[model samples]
Target: MSAEQGTHTHHDDRATVARHAVAADAAALDQAQRTASPIAGRAAGAPSGLDAAYATQHALIARRTDRGERVVGVKLGFTSRAKAEQMGVADVILGTLTDAMGVDDHGRYDPRTAIHPRVEPEVAYLLGPGVEDELAEPDPSASIAAVAPALEVIDSRYRDFRFSLDDVVADNASAAAFAIGPWRRPADTGPMDNRAVSLEFDGRLVQAGSTAAILGDPGRAIAAARRLAGRHGFALRAGMILLAGAATAAVPLPATGVVGAEIAGLGRVSLRVGDGARTEAR
Candidate 1:
């Protein structure tokens, strides 16, 4: 039934159909995260447009906040042409980040709350005020206070990490957990777009790339974040962070293993996950 219907279905109107579709999709997503299990994607006639999908995602996050989860910041997706091509889309997307989705650096993370979790190294931005100005100039550093080596834990709510582009968008861009190393002043991590990053799993190099791959410059991703999120009444607040998308393809995170990353000059960041037998760390 449409959100307006408040109930009833079977021969539901188009608007009602969309409402029921979005509600079911959001419920499935929330349940997936709670049980750390994957679910099937939305059916072909469900909320399949980006605008409609994002509206559902925003509502999902709002429900979490109502339950006491504090918003921490935001993150960008499809920051590279390759990623856009892979997804059959041409625009980058933004997702909400929350304090509850953070794992301490150098500390243990619970692998129990994720289904086929994966990790990717990325450049993270610590925001300052006036980001709107920088976004206007298409220059992200002017509004960034610092940079850090970050690791993002992404868990697709869909089975086997399989989903259509719209499905992923509705799933909050696959965001899960995140950790960042010591923050460094812009002087140290100058020209973020050119930094080199590498990810090592259990001490073996697994993925590596340059930030340039992120929309030609990681900064542009931030600009995109500001513009896109602004439409939803979000502002670039100081102290907020922005995970500038993956530098390379994500690597499967094992139940028990060390995940570490290095950025050219931002220093190192890492997290450990114990045997998957545990269930409360999240």
Candidate 2:
């Protein structure tokens, strides 16, 4: 074969390998989610880099979108500096959120929907129209229409919830489900930073934290999301929800009970598990 022929053949071979790897990763994760069973043994085909990991993530989320689940927003992970430090990473991660993942306030979050689920407190932002235009501005949080108290359920598809950064990224940041309370105008909510936060299981306080734990201010998460979305070549449409990273450590979701999170001045949001269920300083 000529030299040009060999180069083309090698390129095609690499492309084929990448496609196969992404398909396998997506299939494994999809099956685990659908069966509510965690997979053991991270295989050789698992994504080994950020690009491959995110490709797997997109393919995984695409499976649900193809099944009619609409993407409603995005969720961030490891936004807390302390948590990032703990994880030995310098940056945060993000995951897509679909309509299927949202549990209404006071709505039930079926434990059978996830594998080894855990819950954490978060601050959610509602984006306004033209928000995408603000992504490059000095303050991207200016795109926020409102803020709310929220909870995110994380269930790693991997056994024992053990995985590397790339592994978790490929699993959609371990995102399983989420719930948001009534929206409060950002003006009415006061500073996004330093809001007292708490999570309760059946009226028993399970965890407590502050919105300041979310990258020093939950609003900053929007900026991070904007950059990440742009880097991934996805648009952040108006009306999309952004769940800032957890403000407190996650606790295992109870088999059955009411899990609630309250943000000072923002109000409260809750999820009912079969019952129901961070770190920081940016």
Highest TM-score: give the candidate number: 2
Which digits, one per residue and each the tens of the lDDT, describe model 2 over residues 140-195?
44688888899999999999988888888889999999999999898887887898
Q: Which 10 successive residues of model 2 have the least lDDT summed?
A: 273-282
Q: Give the TM-score (vs. native) of candidate 2.
A: 0.94
Score every model by TM-score: 0.87, 0.94
| Residue pairs in collision within model 1 | 2-16
Global lDDT of each model?
A: 0.82, 0.86
- On the 0 to 100 scale, the lDDT of residue 245 in model 2 is 92
After superposition of all CA atoms, the RMSD between model 1 and the true structure is 5.2
Error of 1 at 180 (Å): 0.8
